[model samples]
Target: MFLKVIKHKTAWLAVLAACLSACNTGNSNRPTDTPTSGTIHISVDETYEPLIEAELKVFHSLYPNTHIIADYKPEAECFKDLLNDSARLIIATRELNAQENAYFKQIKISPRSMLLAWDALALVTNRENPDSILTMDQVRNIMDGTDKERKWQIVFDNPNSSTVRYIRDSLNKGKPLPPNTMAAKTNPEVVDYVARNKAAIGVIGVNWISDPNDSTSIEFTNKVTVVKVRADYGSEFVKPYQAYIATGSYQLKRGCFFVLREPYRGLGTGFATFLGSYEGQLVIKRFRLFPARINAVFREANIQ
Candidate 1:
C-alpha cells in the first residue's frame, strides 16, 4: 500500500512537471505566424516615404492594436527584404518579375501585387535657371551625358533608386545611366543640389514636391523649379499634376505597387487591402498622387 501511494505521488509529480515545462515554453512547438492585430514590418522605397508615412499614421489610428514598422530604402533593398522574409510587404515602382514569381512558386508562396497610386518622375531645375522646358529627347540625352546643347549635370536621389531605374528603363531602353548622373542621398537632397547649382537638373518623384498642404512641398519648390517636360519633340510641355498624370499628359508617370507575400490573412494583407480601399484611394489623392481607383469627391463651386 505504501509503495502504491509513493508511485501515485510520483506520477502526479511527473504530470505536474510536464505541465509546468509546457507552460514555460509557450508556443514553442507552434510555427511562428503573424496576425492582423499584431506587429509587423514592411519596406518601402524612400521616394514614397512621405506618402507611406501618412498612410501609416491613418492606419495606426484606425487599428490601434496593430503596430507597423517601416524601413525606407532603395527599391532593390525592399525587394530583397520581401524575399528574405524580413518584411511582409514592399512598396515599389514595379511588380515582381517572372524570376521573382518563379522563386515564390518554388517557395510555395504567391505574392499579391496591388497598384496603389499613379506618380510621376518629376524633373526639376534651379529656380533661377531659365531653362524650364525640355523635350523628352533632350532629357534622355542629358541622362546619357550626350547632350551637346549644354554642359548638363543630372542629379538623382540614389543610383539604385526606383526613380533612376524608371528613367533608365523608360528613357534609355534598359541602357546604363550616363556618367553625368550625379547621386544625391535622397529626393530632398536632389532638390537641394539642383537649387544650389545652376546647371544641375534634379530628377525626382512628383509627390515630394506637389503637396500644397504640406510645408515640405513649399520648401522644396521654393528652392527649385519643377521643370515642365514635353513628351516628345513639338509636344506641349506638361507638369506632373494629378490631372496631367490622369490624362496621360505627364510624360514620366509611373505606377506605385504594394507587393505582399503574406501566406495568411495577416497584417500585410490588411495593409494592402486598406491601400486599395476607398479611404485608401482618398489618402492617395490627398497626398497629391492619383489613386489607382478614382475616389475623389467633386463638388461644383462658383467663384465671383
Candidate 2:
C-alpha cells in the first residue's frame, strides 16, 4: 500500500513538472499563432488629401485595432516614396507611367493599381466677372501661351502638378505650354488669386468646390464662380457637377488611382478593396466626385 501511494504521488509531480516546463519554455505542444497588428503607411498626393483623409477617418472607425499613417505630398514626391519602399500604398490622380512601371519591374516590384473615382478639372473665375463660360479652344490658347496677347488671364494650380500637365496637354495637344501662364504654389493660393483678380481664370480640381450645402461652398461660390466648358454645339457648356460627370458630360475629367507595390496583399490590398467598396464609393460621391462603379439601383430607389 505504501509503495503504491508513493508511486502515485511521484507520477502527479512528474505531470505538474512537465506542464510547468512547457509553460516556462514558451513552447506549447499545441499549435501557437500570434495575432498580427501594425500600422499601414500611406502616401498620397496633396490634390487628393482631403478626400483621402475623410476616407481614412471612416476606415479607422471600422478598423479600430489597426493604425494608419498618411503622408501627403505632391504626386511626383509620392511616387518617389513608393519607389523607395517608404510607403505601402500611394493614392494619386494619375496612374504610373510606362517608365515608372518599368522601374518597378526592374526593382522586382510590379505595381498593382486601381481606379477609385473620376474627378474633373475645374476652370474658375471671380464671381464678379461677367463671363461664366469658356470653350476648350480658348482655354487651349491661353494655356499654350499662343494667345500672345494674354487676353484671357490664366493661372495653374501648381507648378509641378497633374493640373498643370492637364492644362498643357489639353492645350498643346502634343506641344508644350508657354511660360507666360501663372503657376500658383498651392490650390488655396490659386483660389485666392482668382478671387481677387477678376481677369484671371484659375484651373483647379473640382474637389475644391465641394460641399453644395455647406458654408464653405456657399462662400466659395459667392466669391468665385466655376466656368462652364463646352465641347460641342448641342452639348451645352456645363459646370463640373456630379451628375454631369456620371453621365460622361465632363470632358476634362481624370480618374483617381490607388497605386501599390506588387502582390497586392496586406495593407495595399485592404486599402484598395475599401476604396472600391460601397461605403468608399459613397464617400467619393459625398465629395462630389463620381465613383467608378455606378450604383444605378441605389440611385433609382433613392430618387423620390
Candidate 3:
C-alpha cells in the first residue's frame, strides 16, 4: 500500500466497465452486504498523493481485512481508469463532462460524484530566489505566451494534470501555453527541479507542500519555498496555507472530487463515503487542505 506513485507506477491498466444488470443480479465479483470489507482499486490524481495516501493509511489501519490498490496518475489517466472500469473509484479535480456522462450512461454505470476537499494550486521556487510573490496578472502573462521581456520557466507535474489545466485554462483564460512551460513526471519532481534550478518556478497542488506537521511536506519545505500569490481582486499576497485557501486569498484554488461508478452499495461506495466522513475531513484538515464535506474554521486572534 506504500507504493511510490512518484513518476509512474504502471502503464494504463484498462478494463471493461461492468454492466448494471450483472451487478444487480448479485454478481460474484461485487459486494453483497454493507461492503465494509473487500479488495478494490481506486484511481487518484497524482497531485493528491500526500493527502490521499494519508487517508488510505488510516482507512487500512481501521479495516485490516479490506485491501485498496491505489493507482496515482495524471487527471486524464485517472478519468480513463474510471471510464474503462479498471478503477471503479477516482479522486479528481472535476466531475464527468457531458460526453463522459453519456459514455457512462451507455454502459449503464451511474457515477456518484461528490466534493471531497478544496486544494489550492501552489507556486514554488528555489529558496535562493528572492522573488517570492507573484501577482495574478504576472501569472496570467507568463502562461499567455505573449511576454518576451519576462522569460520565466514554468513547470508542472504533468501536461495532462489538473494543475496544468487550471493554470492554462483558468489562469490564462484560453490562451495558448507558452513554449517555456515544462512538465515533470510528478509533483516532487517539480519541487526538486525548482530547488535545483534557481530560474524555474513550479506549480503543484497544495497537498504536496502544505502541512508543517507532515514529514513529507516538511521535506518539500526544505527543498523549495512556496510562492505567495496576489489575489486578482485584492492587494494582499498569500501562500496556499489553509487560511489563505479557505478565505479565497489564494487565487489558483481547485476542488477535489470523488467520482464513483458503483451500481450498488459496494466497496466503492463505502470508500467514497469514508472520504467525506467526519474522520476523513479531519485527516484532510491535518494536511492543510479544506474539507468540502464538513465545516472547518481557522480564526485569527491577536496574541498581544
Q: Name the candidate that leads on TM-score.
A: 1
lDDT score of residue 26 within candidate 2? 78
Best by lDDT: 1
Count the clashes in each prediction.
Answer: 0, 0, 0
Q: TM-score rank, highest first?
A: 1, 3, 2
Q: What is candidate 2's local distance difference test score?
A: 0.76
Which residue pairs in candidate 2 have backbone atoms (N, alpha carbon, C) closer than 3 angstroms, thus clashing?
none
Give one digit per residue, the lDDT tens place, for model 3 in 186-211.
99999999999998889988888877
C-alpha lDDT (0 to 100) for residue 255 of candidate 3: 91
- In the range 1-304, model 2's lDDT, one tens digit per residue, is 9999999999999999999997978765332211123467788877776688778888778777657688876778888888888886898888889888888778787788888888888888988887777776666676776665446677876677878776666556767766557878777778889999988888877876786655655566677889888764426888887777767676778889898773534655666778889988888898889888656323534556
Candidate 2 at residue 243, lDDT? 74
lDDT of 1 by residue, 1-304 (tens): 9999999999999999999999879868453434447788899999998888888988888888888899999999999999999998999999999999999999999888978888888899988889998888887888777788788788989888998898788888888877777899999999989989998899888889877788998899889988888775335888887877876777788999999987777888888888888877888898778898765544556998
Given candidate 3, what's the lDDT at residue 202?
90
| Candidate 1 Cα deviation (angstroms), residue 40 | 0.9
List clashing residue pairs in candidate 1.
none
Which stretches of model 3 miss by more than 4 angstroms?
A: 1-34
List TM-score per model, in order. Answer: 0.91, 0.80, 0.88
